[model samples]
Target: MTDTAIQTRQREIASEHLLFKLIEYVEDRHPGLLDFLEQSLDHLGDPADDASKDDAGVRAIAQRMITGARRQGTD
Candidate 1:
């Protein structure tokens, strides 16, 4: 494959792996957290945007997930 093709394929694979990891993390920890993340990611205008909105959304989700996981652990 050409370099461009290879890069495209690599990006596709990486996105797939990231999605899988997110799913596994949610399933094994917080059941509905993936949906929350998806909602946040979907509302963003651009993935490359530097508006800080994406970071804020992701951080909020991460905090919620962490709190849920910790509560589960202590239960």
Candidate 2:
């Protein structure tokens, strides 16, 4: 493989590892949060929804996920 391909694969693996850790942490602290996020994402591509709403939803979910993952305590 080329140098760029190797780097890309390394990054993908690292990202997957980090994502798994985040999911495990989130699940342990707040069960069912991932499920709710999956459902919310499913609606983002709905024909009834406008581009602005989709953008807002994506941003909201990203913010919530980041905040939720880093939040301390049982909150």
Candidate whose lDDT is highest: 2
lDDT by residue (1-75, candidate 2, tens digit) is 999999999998899657757775777778887666656654554244555546556657555754555454233
Q: Which stretch of 10 consecutive residues in model 1 shows the poorest summed lDDT?
A: 66-75
Assess the local accuracy of residue 73 in candidate 1 as a C-alpha lDDT between 0 and 100. Answer: 38
- For candidate 2, report its TM-score: 0.52
Best prediction by TM-score: 2
Cα RMSD to native, each candidate? 9.6, 9.6
Model 2 regions more than 4 Å off: 43-75
Q: In candidate 2, residue 18 scores what lDDT?
A: 79
Summed backbone clashes in each candidate are: 0, 0
